[model samples]
Target: MSDVSARDAARDKARDRDGAMSMAGMSSERIESDENVWTRRLVTFLRVMAVISIMKGLYHWAQVTGFIGSEEEAFENQSMAWQTATVYFAVIELVAAVGLWLATPWGAVVWLTTVVSMAVIELMFPGIYGGSLTVVALEAVMLGAYLALAWMAARERPP
Candidate 1:
């Protein structure tokens, strides 16, 4: 090659390397920002869910402890199925709430299980929780939101 052509080629290669390096750095910073954004969203979502779970759990406990109904309609006077359902929810909801508040993987799993279980009971049995369609729909929406946020956060992670 001519001297000028050789020099031009060398310059082009150096420019390409510098451009690649800068692009790499910019992309990494962007990825980190995106990751932080998604992670914060996910954590906030989980904490909100935890609060809801806590409320639900407390409601169930109130029923079991006779704090909600009249003395004549207390937990001891409830049907076997109602008592069983209330007890189950009282325990599981609190457990899941704790997990979600911590934002741990197990918390997500537990919350998912809790949501699915409530949906199932509302759909299949229809008598456990009064079969509230609104409750079921809300649960479905929350579940979808949680899954979407988790997916987005996971995608932002570097390989």
Candidate 2:
């Protein structure tokens, strides 16, 4: 082979080798730490949270509209308008989570905003049961989940 041909072949081989490890839907970034790997998995979980957040908002809206009742009595503590607002906010939160998982730049913004909302609400609201037995659980969990998604996504260098 000519020098140019040999050089081209070498570059192609290197690229192929780099690509091989990523085979079939795998990512090129190899996570070095176990915690970081789990953090990435949390991003996938956050993607699922996209659907859950929307559903949760709908459920609240349903309650306010009289289509459903709160599974927990604590919801009775909140007013109908408050419930409605919660529904609207939750839906927005869900949409943002989805956007983030999709790697839209706005996703990080949504995640940060919602997680702050979550932290604040969790501090304010006491559920039907004491000591963490409430929808506060969701606020708590999703707060971390959104943060994790944002963090991991930041680490991700898109292919």
Candidate 3:
């Protein structure tokens, strides 16, 4: 072959070899790490919490719209405190749910705030939600789980 053709063939072979090496490097880099596993678990937990938040928000909205109560217990007929709480929760819970679903930092903050607020209300102002200890306990457990998962995921990250 001519010198020019020989040079071109050598360059093509080099490029092919480099391409194969890069592909192999990419596959090796894809090996699952502890951080990746923990992050995925955290994401899944957040998604589940988001669904629960959505349901809670919808429930509050139903209450406010008189869709889940008797005529006498309608939103207009409820005490001012109940009306205010229902509306506040109806809006905030849904917002928090969206944030959580997105798996963003702000979403976790918002969700935590919502959980703590509900727990406090249930404990300190029993009249609002009729003081369900069960609800408070559940919220505490969920909060603990979230914190644990977040801690694990963060710890697994490379410094």
Candidate 4:
């Protein structure tokens, strides 16, 4: 290829990389600028995560203090492993919830951290958790949401 053609090709590649986030897909400039929609979404994700965390914290507190019960009335079930898992999961959820609510860097950190943590845990101990699939999918979506907002906010450089 000609030198001029090679230069054009390189420039085109760079543009393509930038275009992935060029924001050209945004239909309305006002919405894009205000982030009213985005903020609502971010807040929703954060709140859900936060509430889950708070509930989880409370759940763990109950288990650690020997307060959790089995109203199922089936097989006298409940074990140390279950208690430990309850607390562990609760702690992670609590951190994620708080971080998200505050919208601090910690929240973003928690999002990424817990997303990977839960995914790894699910793979590591599939049978241990009854609702791992639901939890993983939820966290994965939240993680994506947080990351997208973070990237947009950073790239937009709003003043």
Candidate 5:
């Protein structure tokens, strides 16, 4: 090969070794940026939320099983339907918590459903379920966070 062609080939090889080709149009200096930090923080926050959901589910299970509170205290004066619904809540919460821990889309969907179901039940039967504004607030905040993360993730593009 001509000397000029060989020089060009060597330069191409050096550029490839430096990740110039693999990075598409991105510069090596711009490869690692604030986006990475935000992505990491978002993932960490989601995982922490998952852990909280798991703990909340376990707490509900404990309440339902009379481990933390007496069965009579938990179901006292509540109708049979409310008691049954409590059991359902415990089961769904635990399952959704597991899904959230796995970071799957279905996990978020199920968790939102569980939250909405609980909110609706509490609202519709304030007496039977003993509704609390705190539940609504917590669920709203969590849902907001989930939605924001999803929006941000979707907006993210190669830079």
Candidate 6:
């Protein structure tokens, strides 16, 4: 073979070898890290958070729709603003949950924003949204877990 043809053949072989271990059905920027424990843990954490987010969304939706309890029970005689906020939270949270489940960058960002926003709303509105110390504590814990997993995944280069 000519020199140029031989070099092209060698390069193709190298690419094929590298591609063998690459993940399929994911973005090109994603990298498989099966050997990395941190990646595995991070994925698990994200999935767990996704489930929680979905459940939270559903709960809020039930409240807003008056399926779970009376309107008074859900809103606790809160103003229209608080009631509207509840509906908004339900929709945004459900969307964010799906994004997080897909392991997309936007999902993480949305989930983080949703959690923080909920915490703030609860704190500011207090009894209007059935805010409680327990809810705040749980949010803090989940937020910490998400941040730690994100940092680990970034460091490990998860697939």
The list of candidate 1 runs beyond 4 A from truth reads 1-32
Which lDDT values do the candidates have, in the order given? Answer: 0.91, 0.63, 0.91, 0.68, 0.75, 0.81
Runs off by more than 4 Å, candidate 5: 1-42, 74-77, 157-159
lDDT of 4 by residue, 11-37 (tens): 999999778657655535533446455
Which has the greatest lDDT?
A: 3
Error of 2 at 12 (Å): 17
In model 2, which regions exceed 4 Å deviation?
A: 1-43, 70-81, 125-138, 145-159
Which pairs clash inside model 2?
Answer: none
Query: Tens-digit lDDT track for model 1 on 1-159?
Result: 699999999999999999998889888454444437888999999999999999999999999988898998789887888889889999999999999999999999999998998898898978666899998999999999999999998887876
lDDT-sorted candidate list, best first = 3, 1, 6, 5, 4, 2
Q: Any idea what lDDT model 1 has?
A: 0.91
* Range of the 10 consecutive residues with the lowest summed lDDT in candidate 5: 27-36
| Candidates sorted on TM-score, descending | 3, 1, 5, 6, 4, 2
TM-score of 5: 0.72
Best by TM-score: 3
TM-score per candidate, chains pooled: 0.77, 0.49, 0.81, 0.57, 0.72, 0.70
lDDT, candidate 6, 36-115, per-residue tens: 77777877888888898899899888887778876567665657877888888899889988988888889988988888
In model 3, which regions exceed 4 Å deviation? Answer: 1-33
Give residue 86's error in model 2 in angstroms. 2.6
Stronger candidate by lDDT (3 vs 4): 3
lDDT of 4: 0.68
Per-residue lDDT tens digits of candidate 3, residues 11-111?
99999999998898888566655547888999999999999999999999999888898999889988887788889889989999999999999999999
**Candidate 2: C-alpha lDDT:** 0.63
